[model samples]
Target: MLPLSLLNTAKGHPILVELKTGAHCHPKSPTLCEYIDQRSTVDRVTYNGHLHSCDNWMNINLHEVICTSAGGDKFWRLAEVYIRGSTIKYLRLPDQIIDIVREDREFRERRETLSGNGTGRGGRGGGSGGRGGYNNNRGGRGGGGAPRGRGGFSKQQN
Candidate 1:
């Protein structure tokens, strides 16, 4: 396993894991890569989650991997995998990323449709259902509000 710190490196080339078992290399950190080459490819690749900045081009699985923060989480995730940094082919997604992407796409489509006429979901200019009434200032839903108990009954004090 790669160290936690290495998994999130924001400077050098990304650590590459050989598609075939037992081959790994860090193009930037040659020493590490050399060591990895001696190891069996079947070994699991481990890293601290740091990788070079997305500003630079990186090839992973023969695709360009664009790294970015996930929900501002401390760990970084593949934002977009491009064939040539412009044309996106596959998305390197972590678990649960699908929902976020789907939600974003849905929101954008709803906004566009709403702006076109007077129909759509929450977004700017779509009536109360639009972004009009929703408070931008409001943050995420966060944790659930005060928990509710059975039927309208409140917990009795001892």
Candidate 2:
């Protein structure tokens, strides 16, 4: 599945985003920290590490993410983050989303099987006489007209 599709499926679920470089962290002494910014949704991310403190929560933009706690103790209460699509290394998705995707796939497979339209490819007698179907002479070379010669038209000699 596409990355956007997976992101859509992961909506309203917790996600961990790992960035490509340590450029977004402390500028003077840049350190490559595994800055795991745990967010509820992947929308409008900014990677600056400036922390915003809310009631027992820290609202951070993607531009404000520092190093994650080594012991996994610190958690950021991000409001909305907008990370550049290019900077994202990988996304960690919840396990439940996997089951959802699998079920959806199985359902689609079953539907295709029941309708006899496996893979939506040209089925028996469905294509334009190229495969499986009989060539009805409906298409190609102007509907069975006389085959054109190299001279552009047949020279009629009286």
Each model's lDDT: 0.33, 0.43
Q: Residues 1-158, candidate 2, lDDT per residue (tens digit)?
A: 65555555655555666665532433332222234334323332223232222111222233334334334544554334545455556656678877887788789889866764323643232212232212332222222223221212333549
- RMSD per model, one decimal: 17.6, 12.8
Q: Residues 1-158, candidate 1: write the lDDT tens digits.
A: 12222222323334332132343343554445555555444243333322334433433232233222212222223332222222222322243334545566678788866655334432223222322212333212221112221111223449
Lowest-scoring 10 consecutive residues by lDDT in candidate 1?
Answer: 143-152
How well does each candidate superpose onto the true structure, as a TM-score? 0.31, 0.46
Off by over 4 Å in 2: 23-76, 122-134, 137-158
